[model samples]
Target: MLEGKVAIITGAGGGIGRDIALLMAQQGAKVLVNDVGASLGGEGRNAGPAQSVVTEIETAGGVAAANTDSVADASNAKRIVQNALDAFGRVDIVVNNAGILRDRFFHKMSDDEWDAVLKVHLYGSYYVSRAAAEPMKAQASGAFVNMTSTSGLIGNLAQANYSAAKLGIAGLSKSIALDLDKFGVRSNCIAPFAWSRMISSIKVDSDEQAARVEKIKQMTPAKIAPLAVFLASDSARDVNGQIFAVRNNEIFLMSQPRPVRSVQRSEGWTPQSIAEHAIPALRPSFHSLDVSADVFSWDPV
Candidate 1:
């Protein structure tokens, strides 16, 4: 479906990013696989992962190039996009899947942890998309598949930094969609539930927890790639600013942010009036503060 397209997939060294890179290539998109090859916690780096994926694509008779630049760095992000333009002459799709996890309770979270997570996930998306947007705008055609998360969309314990960054990404994607719509560029966010190196680091405190994690691991990262490929294809030309989730074989179209209820007084709301009238008026429509796990209670399909 993406034949003749040129795509840049960040964090394509492994997991979901790797799967998307491979699928895009297989669909005949010339891929620029960008990966800093960092560990799960955003530590260390290597070029092997990126190069290996490039080799795999080449072996499969697909065109691909490897880039070992940290998406967290603005200069590096520009270079990554430049690499794609230099190699392919045009950029058609960009998948911002680069991320890191620094799971910690809010009270225990270090400044470094928060900064690192935000830098990579939020700022990284901004930098890469910023660099790619100009070229895409000039061409008057492009698609962006940004990675968001349930943790951010809903909520999750011990992932304040991650949740913040993910939510920011969703907002960023929406704004980008609006900003680029006239240019014929589209942007969407994906909250993917897949078994990857990042997911493998879940803390299991008991046998049941281990079993659950194992079950989760069965939802291979590859399963999430098809949706990304679809979103990046011409088939999704009219789809923009939408959020989606992929769990096992199930694909969910998440509702965008909108006002559920409103109350008005001729005088407008004062604190006392809000507490006395508006709060109660809007109570029925108020959503509970449920986390992602609480909402997704069913076993993976």
Candidate 2:
């Protein structure tokens, strides 16, 4: 579906990114696999992960190049895009799948923990996408598939940093779709339900949580690649600024933020009036403090 196209899949060393890179190449996109083999907490680096994925792609009769640049830095991110251009001539797709997790309760989270997570998942997506925007605009066509998470869309325990970063990515993607649509560049987000290195970080403290993890394991990283490939292909031209979720075999067009209920007064209301009248009317529309797992209550069949 992506014949002659060139793609950059960040964090393409392993997990969901690796699967996406392989599928993109298999579908005929010359892929630039970028990774800075860091641990889940965004510490240290090795080139083995990226180089290995590149080798895997090449061995499977696909075109790919390995890049060990960290997307967390703006200059390195630009270098990543430039490398893709140098390798494949013109850029066509960018999958912002690079991420790290530093799980901690809000009260106990450290500044470094917050900054490190945001720098990798949120800023990294922005840095890479900003660099690729110009090339896509110049060519008058491109697609971006960003990885978001239910942790953000719904909620998650002890993941303030991660949820915030993922939610910011959703907004960034929407802004990109709006800003680049005129130039024929499209952007979308994927909230994937998959068992990967990222998900392996989940803290399973209860029997129920363990069972949930087992169910999640059934939805492997491979299940996510098809949707990523589709969103980054010409086939999804009409689909822009949309959020999607992939579970085992199910694909969902997730809902975006929209006003569900409203209360208005012709005359300006005071706080007291709002408290007395609006609060009662709007209470039913208010959302509960439910986490991702709570919202996804049923197992994916």
lDDT string, candidate 2, 189-257, tens digits: 999999999889888899999999999999999999999999988999999999999989999989999
Write one digit per residue (lDDT tens) for candidate 1, span 105-179: 999999999999999999999999999999999999999999999999999889999999999999999999999
Q: How far in Å is the alpha carbon of 217 misplaced in model 2? A: 0.7
TM-score of each: 0.96, 0.99
Give the 10-residue window scoring lowest on summed lDDT in candidate 2. 292-301
In model 1, where do residues sit more than 4 Å from their true spots? 206-208
lDDT of each: 0.94, 0.95
Clashes of each: 0, 0
